[model samples]
Target: MLDDFMTRATLAGVGTALAAAPLGCFVVWRRMAYFGDATAHAAILGVALSLAFSMPIFVGAMIVALVMAAAVTLLTGRGYAMDTLLGVMAHSALAFGLVAVSFLSGVRIDLMAYLFGDILSVSHVDLAVIWGGALLVVALVAWRWSALLTATLNPDLARAAGIDPRREQLVLTLALAVVVAVAIKVVGVLLITAMLIIPAATARPFARTPEAMAAFAVVLAMVAAWIGLQTSYQFDTPTGPTIVCVVAVMFAVSSIASTLRRAG
Candidate 1:
């Protein structure tokens, strides 16, 4: 039987994988990997706010992430290069969050844990929060899948079809925020975007359809989480980064195999 901590940690990691994988399909399709990083970075600032005000960390992270996503969407679409905007926003949020967390008084914060994740140390309450946020994201994405795919393919087409592309974008944005909030516990701020993007990228070669890519991404992510946990346990490495490293390796292997298949 798994110990309680191991069980909670497993659940936390798996739940995070479940939410991040499918939504990450949209992130990959939209070429919004940097945007995801921006939101995840903003989550660190949310942590500061939550710690300072004694609020729930999940709530704080979600609110700040949503605001950041909205701000980027509003500011970047008018003649600005979104890639540049997202890069600026992502790094700026991380820097500001680190500085702000340093200034918090009274309560001590685990800087490294928030930066690199402390999955093995996750509490039962944190487990509940993680699963809750993950499910909400999954449900939101499932509900809007068709509309989102259409908008992602062509916003003008979506508009002509009477679908408001912006609304679908907002739905994705909301789901992303929730995923970032919950993922902070499993993979921390710096590595959270990798958890979203890598598995999806790895699955891309094997998947003919968006749905297949998403399913494969989820499966790959779950495997990474489990293997990463075991690897970290055996080597006494950092859990979150360990998971990301495993995912990165998988991506490398997939890329190589895909290239060889194409060559043949």
Candidate 2:
């Protein structure tokens, strides 16, 4: 039974890593770390809503994430600094979510689980949700990969080519919403951004092109997930943070290697 549980956990972790890897590339490319954080932080509000409504936690989280994305897009369209707006929304949503969760009369919510995740507890149903959401996100991204890349690399160029940058931004935001919803269970709100950023950041040093970078990021994320899981098992530590720490270590190593290569 122990082995079975570990196997299941490992599979779930890999699936999450695969899904996060590609989207994470876009997050890094566009410098959307703050946006990712804002979306993930708003997930706490989704958790609160799920508890209150007795809905699936992922559903609540996805809805709130999409709403937050829309709000951010609108705010930015009105000329607000994206980082500043994201920061405000991130902290405000987190605070409101905490307060909202506290108002529940019965059934105490595990704060740690929402913040840092409880990967070992992922059910078969949860796996289905993760994979399904991931497929949709990957499909959407693949279908629009060129346009998205063009918009990210040069919005003016994409616009001149008749690709609406605003529309692509919306698509990216929606993709991010799905990613946050699926990943919340794997890495929780606090570490989800790390999963999205670190792998892509690490891959940057090795990639010769944007496509290679994205693919490398996915591979790194998967490796990190496996190594982190093994380490968690060996050390009897929390899986989500452990995985994030592994990804961080990979980023550090990649940074050093990149610096040395440049120097040499």
Which candidate number has the best lDDT? 1
Model 2 C-alpha lDDT per residue in residues 155-195, reported as the tens digit of each score = 99999999999899989988888888888888899999999
Note the Cα lDDT for every prediction shown: 0.92, 0.90
CA shift of 256, model 1, Å: 0.9
Residues 146-193 of candidate 1 have per-residue lDDT tens digits of: 899999999999999999998998998999999999999889999999
Assess every candidate by TM-score: 0.97, 0.96
**Model 2: colliding residue pairs:** none
Candidate 2: segments with Cα more than 4 A from true spot: 1-3, 77-79
> Could you tell me how far off, in angstroms, the CA of residue 29 lies in candidate 2 after the best superposition?
1.4
* Steric clashes per prediction: 0, 0
